[model samples]
Target: MSICSYLWCLIISLSCVAPLSGNPAAVKEQISLKREKTITNIVNGVPTIDKKFFARINMPYRDKVCGGVVIDRWWVLTAARCVDHVSDHQYELRNVFIEIGNFTTGSQQKKTYKAKAIVIHPMYNLTTNSHDIALIKLVKRAPMFRVAELCSEPVEYGTEVGACGLGSTPARHPSPSASLHEIFLRGIFFSFASFFEIDFCPDDQVCTEPITDGASICNLDEGSPLYKLQCHSRAAECILGIASHFVASEHSEINCSGGSNFASVPHPYEWISETIVFDFLFNSGHLDRSF
Candidate 1:
């Protein structure tokens, strides 16, 4: 279906739902009514038909949610800032859970795994938003889900890519969508992203603009996978980057109007590989720790 038609259908479908007004009673009723149905619009995007490699990083204690990609049987990749609370002692690995193999955020059938460890890039700078990627170690292997392969080369400018996430549509709903949504974006040069107010786009980041009108990344989309299909097969998608942040001038704004930035997967491929391998060998007692 076309983007416009899809959006129209979403509007018609939600027209009957209770409006989330300032009335506490109305808000409570709306919440109660939709507790079992979280599926909503995706800022003009469409619902994803398949979500094999998609993952959701849930921090229930902090009431935070971020998107993730399953990279290995026991590892997932996401934005470092999503789990940065760990550095400040606000939360721990025990509080982080990775949910996979589900399209809806409210689905009770998805597989959940505890985070055994989280490795944030040593060079990650919260202030500058540089090196924003991180690796999460799952306590149990997630072999039932497909693992997304990191792109070996940088995505070319003007290349079309897909971004999937369970984020909010500020215009439609303030809450994250119950269902997964996918949007198509075209990569553009950092020079073209002048509206983002960034003096220069770092090499470690990939910049993309929405291909469809009104489509954009929203709140809770952080760390979501931005991928490209391999051989045009939806099932064979490769990870190109993870949703980093919106670099708009208004840093406080959650609506991504200018464009979105992603931490390039290829830029940190070496670190990711080394971290996974070293962690495996060290845990298996195959590597000597006393150097």
Candidate 2:
């Protein structure tokens, strides 16, 4: 196969951390603390390794919260709710930065980009959380970063997909994790017969439960990618959905374990394609001057 074809095939396959040195006593004490297992917010997830291409969406003040996947050299795919901070349904892209390559927040191995523009789906509805996908354009091309390929194949029930993010644990993470974490989720059937069900896992979404009984996405995990491993390639994975919201038992509580709803990429591939094309053209109009 040609280089371009191989690369595109890889694209269709969409697809951490740290410590210090010191005095003997102090070092032993630090190692002891590190070995101690704290309650994780993601339930049963584990930390991801290096070289994976994921996006950590942070606010102007460097507060990393939401998660995203790089889809192009200059564009990232994330949940619309992550960047839609305004309440009046207006387009107000916030001053946010995209952190790439660094699993841990402050690591020098990562690349940072100032978001040049935010594009939320025009038909997104906050009341019901429908059409929940969005794209962010970086100020410049991320040639060194790996980009995920957009996949339109339907996800089958019972397919196990992997999700990664910097979300905190239920006790409320003191701050975002230094490393990106991952969890395996299995596809499930969602019945939209009732109004309540429709409100949570609407027609346009896909429902998934953690492969482990207690695994779940916490407060800061919104917009993370839901992807499947490539059929024969360990290094390649395909993007199937974008984490939008979750559904837990009715209770006045935080960090409850439950299933999550993802904005189905296959269902709205056209919209995504059109939006990306329009944004690229709009932004690239001045490229020739620089070229």
Candidate 3:
């Protein structure tokens, strides 16, 4: 990708707030202080996702900033941008870990796993935000965490969906929430998005706006999952989209006050299935490869 393309990619990050400073020490200190203050406010009192199906993506150099959902005992699906770093080559992120079975960011009891490998969609383009999905392999299986089932059903316009993440709340804070926070968003059609001057990517992407006021995904975990509850059972949730970019409204450049786009997991169902299956077979010694 050209420098211009790369710059466009940065816009897709959790860029609702100012970008992190160059000094690693300063960034780390800021994260620590932010964690200390998170308990005082829970980001609009949004409840955290259940401990069983949620995961927090943390960097060794930075605090937890991204979110992911468990796909199986060994795999997680998140936005490619969350773990993407300019300094690293594709399919590799340094010192990335995920915390599972932990609801609070300050908790000491979460099961953390070092990432074994990372894979981004082969067709993912930074310029157009196409195929913005990524898969992560953990060094060990997290059998205790509940797996999220993939859904292939097409999403209709105006469907109510739920999104959760460790992202910060709008209007009140720039730091991420200490605990997971969730909000309900009603899906919107891509065509309608243009009328409101919102960025809507319908090709392999889904868009949503907050159902409540003063709620925007602004700086939430980049790879948080968007869920569609099963029609018959409230207990079951089908993974629909992986959070990618939050578009700022024309009036404000600092917040995703208008809407956000997620890479549609179901839209590229074949890619997701093939990627997961290939990894599974290779790891189990059923497939041979020369690398």
Best by lDDT: 1
Cα RMSD (angstroms) for every candidate in the order listed:
13.0, 13.2, 14.4
Backbone collisions counted per model: 1, 5, 1
Question: Stretches of candidate 1 above 4 Å error?
Answer: 1-42, 87-91, 105-107, 169-172, 189-198, 231-236, 248-254, 284-291
Rank list by TM-score = 1, 3, 2
- Candidate 3 residue pairs in clash (backbone atoms < 3 Å): 167-220
The alpha-carbon lDDT assigned to residue 39 of candidate 1 equals 15
Stretches of candidate 2 above 4 Å error? Answer: 1-41, 61-64, 86-94, 104-106, 169-175, 189-200, 232-236, 249-253, 282-291
What does candidate 2's lDDT look like per residue over 5-42, in tens digits? 99987765433001123444553342233222211124
* Residues 190-260, model 1: lDDT tens digits: 43333333343566888765667556676688899888754334443589898887533232233454366
What's the alpha carbon RMSD for model 1?
13.0
Q: By how many angstroms RMSD does model 2 differ from the true structure? A: 13.2
